[model samples]
Target chain A: MSRREQAKEENRARIRASAERIIRTEGIDKLTMRRLAEDAGVSLRTPYNLFGSKTDVLIALLEGAGFDPGDALALRDEQLVMEQLFATLDHIEAFFDSDEKFYREVYGGIMSSAHPDVRSTNVERVVAMCQELMTHAAAKNELQIDTNTRELGRYLGVQLLAVLGMWGAEFLSNQESIRQVRRAWCGILLQHCSNASHRAVDAAYQSVALTGS
Target chain B: MSRREQAKEENRARIRASAERIIRTEGIDKLTMRRLAEDAGVSLRTPYNLFGSKTDVLIALLEGAGFDPGDALALRDEQLVMEQLFATLDHIEAFFDSDEKFYREVYGGIMSSAHPDVRSTNVERVVAMCQELMTHAAAKNELQIDTNTRELGRYLGVQLLAVLGMWGAEFLSNQESIRQVRRAWCGILLQHCSNASHRAVDAAYQSVALTGS
Candidate 1:
């Protein structure tokens, strides 16, 4: 990379890391622009120059964590349906590791928001990912059901989100919580497969193979 | 009721209603001793005298909203199975609606707690209720499966908890979210019923009827 670009990257990284640490210690509500800039050992204007505003910084932080800038929408189509399912679930756990409290704060805030951007953008991304997962799973005959796969997928994904929110909030953490969730998820999928009409499964698989779905 | 008992009851109701209003308007974290006193038209010392602490007041608020004192044990009994399951769930929902922000605060507090009183109490209550639900459901041959019914019951319960938390966090309006949850709960229950073997069902029904379970 060019010297100027490298310099800019270093500055942004410093800002994000410092911001993250501040959030870890003080919490999302306490993460002020001045505090972040001071924590990063830079002038207050430095953050404004780099991030524009607190919201931009938040988007940047979440983007860094694989929730923003279309990360949820970028699932690899090459993977098997089950692999995709587990991998995304893995992301839910890892996201908790990165910044647990921030996840809860953002989740609680965006979900409770009346703003159109907040509502539409967050819900659509989740619903889109669900549709993609369910459609692919159905095509592979891994998820069979008479019910709409899109809706089922959405429900499961949101369920994961909910659990993660609870975990972040600190409502769930038995030695067995994750194991329990996995079993429950497995049961849902297994039942869905069992419930699928044989003809429906056959048609879906056939259509998928021919259409590269 | 005796005069002193009646006065205590009035104070309790007054505290709960005032706390609910404050939490709804300004959010839960902002629920300071001073604000509560101002809003409730009582002395600042009154809260401490009446409930001992903010957490105690919250517990009372939840109790006032339908959390029975003996529910943790009552819901675990086989004889009261259906009443237990239904009442436990309805109380859970009532807590969500009694005051959205306070519910978030307390539920958040409960979930992330290292404190035994906070975490263990909730866990004990849930596990007891689930075990009771499963035992009854299994006895009726409603959930005959290869795995333990108690474990299955817990798994399903957590999934519902997870979903309800997100839904309560306001991804949807309260009414619609509750409706969706009830629908999903039925779907889950029906799937279990369908998968149970005939022998298991007959034995379960007999067990349930014999014990009036």
Candidate 2:
């Protein structure tokens, strides 16, 4: 890489670290571009030049904190589609539990923000991830042949977003949030599961229902 | 009907009407207690005495605008449980559609507000309504014997709130929001349905899937 590129990368890293610190300690409301630039020892224009807006900065922070759809998709080969979906939920719960305060502050801020970009970025990523999973399941004949995997994925994505929103808003604990997601996802998948996959999905659904008690 | 009691009722109606006008013409943020009292031509203390807080005032406005669980419950005797559930969703969609601007402003404001009361009130009301419907379904052997209606109700409530939140935020069209809710609700209901109602629920599911195409 060029020296200039290396410097840019280092500067971006510094800014992200500063953002995390500010958001964690002071809350998202305090992490303005000016404050971030001053805290990161960069010019005011540096943040705007790099990230464009506060919403973009928050999105960057989220991505930097390991909010990757790739991680969820990686389980595709190792587990059944239903199990992989549940595992994805587990991963999300673990991600939030890893730093409850940080995730809550970032995610809650994005959820409540009037800026549509951040929320759409999050939703679109999840929808793509779900679509990929559903496509794989359909390939294996686990899902009905006629299933509109994209719409099904979109449905689940919105539901998952809601559960996460509740958790982000402190309405549900990490465990409860994950449990609800699992139960609801299992229930929805049960309706779409082909005969070959119905038992597996139903088993997961029963487990969620039992444990939820 | 003592005159004093009747006068208090009249005052509340006037204050509620004034709150609606302000919230409708201006945004929810502009409908402060002081502004409401001034607009209503009542003493400032009148609003405070009548409603505990701004959140309470918003809730009153919502209730006054036909946001009633009883409306959903009234369908119990006239229709099957699954149909009644979907009809309830229709009722909600119609309620929101009736005054898109007002509902959007009030619900969007409450959803984004840090105050927990408004969101919880909305969720709790839906949860109770769902539980009642599920109980009625179980009574007719439409649902599994051991289904936890309360938890199921809560799950559906959160999902509904999420869809409504998306609609209120303008991320979804009114028709699209209701369609998504109906589709997801059908899928979830299909899982808890017994042999007696599986065909009916699956039929509803198929209709939603077909129309969604």
> Which structure among the candidates has the greatest lDDT?
2
Which candidate achieves the best TM-score against the true structure?
2
| lDDT at position B117, candidate 1 | 68
Error of 2 at A211 (Å): 8.9
Name the top DockQ candidate: 2
Q: For model 2, name the residue pairs that clash.
A: none
lDDT of 1: 0.57
The C-alpha local distance difference test score for the whole of candidate 2 amounts to 0.78
Per-model TM-score of chain A alone? 0.63, 0.90
List where candidate 2 sits over 4 angstroms from the true fold. A1-7, A41-44, A74-80, A210-213, B1-11, B41-46, B210-213
- How much is B109 displaced in model 1, in angstroms? 9.2
lDDT at position B120, candidate 2: 75
Candidate 1 colliding pairs: A170-B111, A170-B112, A171-B111, B139-B204
